[model samples]
Target: MDQYAVFGNPISHSKSPAIHTMFAKQTQQAMEYGVIEAPLDGFEKAVGEFIHRGGQGANVTLPFKQQAFALADQLSEAARLAEAVNTLSFNKGRIYGDNTDGKGLVADLKLQGVTLTDARILLLGAGGAARGVIAPLLSELPASIHVANRTEQRAVELAVQNPSSKLVASGLDNIEGEFDLVINASSASLAGSVPSIRGPLVADAVCYDMVYAATVTPFNLWARQQGASRTIDGLGMLVCQAAESFAIWRGVRPDVNPVMQFLRAQMTQSL
Candidate 1:
């Protein structure tokens, strides 16, 4: 079987192994997928050893996405634009990197029947997670996009990175105006807290929390309390992104709906 894995620090909680295992079974691919917890300061060393052991590819998470980007011998447009890489394929002594997060988000949104064209978008947080998805969202040609962060300068910096007249930046405290789509790309949801912001912003808008829990995320709950039209968590995004990575490695696209439904059922039962 070909070897594949996901690498990260604090990787014990990762769902990548299970997700990929399901995909492998569904596609009847002869592959073994697992998780590797690399030491914080030794990500490169771990990757080198994995490649030495005939590892075929890897899914990178958390702090290592940027490092994976730097380690790539070649990058896809998605990886280059995001300045981060979440999927890596090794071939003929070279590593190819790509970012599937943005494509995953867009795919999930489309599956949910959310329209992006000519709508206003509010992106919370300007960090890697936010950066990875901005270009893809922009491709959907929203009327405008506003990136808000705790630090005003980071938001400004992110907006400037893409250099779009349709994009704007603001501090979280000063966020105003109605947004047809509000996406929480911040780490706040991991802490069971919503990103601090004033609203009227989420009112009647579709809200997406890029974090998923067995139940609704705190950000989505807050959006619901604020009378948002719809709220979605990141489970579908996770499955879609994993599917993209599988396609990259195996050259075949597997259906994501079944995997997503299976995972959702598991989450429900675990509760």
Candidate 2:
């Protein structure tokens, strides 16, 4: 069996193993997926050991994504643009890296019937999560994207990294105008809080939170309270991105709907 795993610092809570297992079963691929909790300072060593043990590929999470980018022998355009690598493949002596998060986000938005063409977008936060999805979002020809962060400089830096006339930057407090879509990529949702932005930004907009929980995420719930047209959590993005990584390793795509349904049921039951 081909061996694969997701690597991170605190990896016990990851759902990647279950998601990939379902993908493997659905695609009839003979592979094993698991998790590796690498020490903060020992990431490279851990990856080397996995490769030595015949590991085929691995998914990276959190702090390790940037490290994986530096370790790759070759990088896909998405990974290069994102400056992070969430998916990795090993063949012979070469390690190939790619970032599937943006593709996954765009795919999920399309699946949910959210229009991206020529829409005004508000992206909250300028962290890695925000960076990974900007390119894909821009590809859809959105009329404009305003990136807002607590630290205005960081958001401005992110906009400069991906220079486009359609993109702009601002501090959260300085955010202006209503958006057709509001995407929460900040860590506020993880703390059960919503980003500090005006309610009108989300009103009548499609609100998406890049954080998932058993119930609606804090950001999504807050968006709904502000009369958002629709609200979605990140579970679909997680599944879709994992499917992208699986396809990279197996050369076959697995149906995501059934897997998403199964995971949703599990989340509800746990609640």
Highest lDDT: give the candidate number: 2
State the lDDT at 216 in candidate 1: 85
User: What TM-score does prediction 2 earn?
Assistant: 0.98
Predicted candidate 2 versus true structure: per-residue lDDT over 114-155, tens digit per residue? 999999999999999999999999999999999999999999
Worst 10 residues of 1 by lDDT: 190-199
Worst 10 residues of 2 by lDDT: 186-195
Show model 2 residue runs off by greater than 4 Å.
none
Per-model C-alpha lDDT, please? 0.93, 0.94
lDDT (C-alpha) at residue 101 in model 2: 100
| Candidate 1: tens digits of C-alpha lDDT, residues 37-123 | 999999999999999999999999987999999999999999998899999999999999999999999999999899999989999
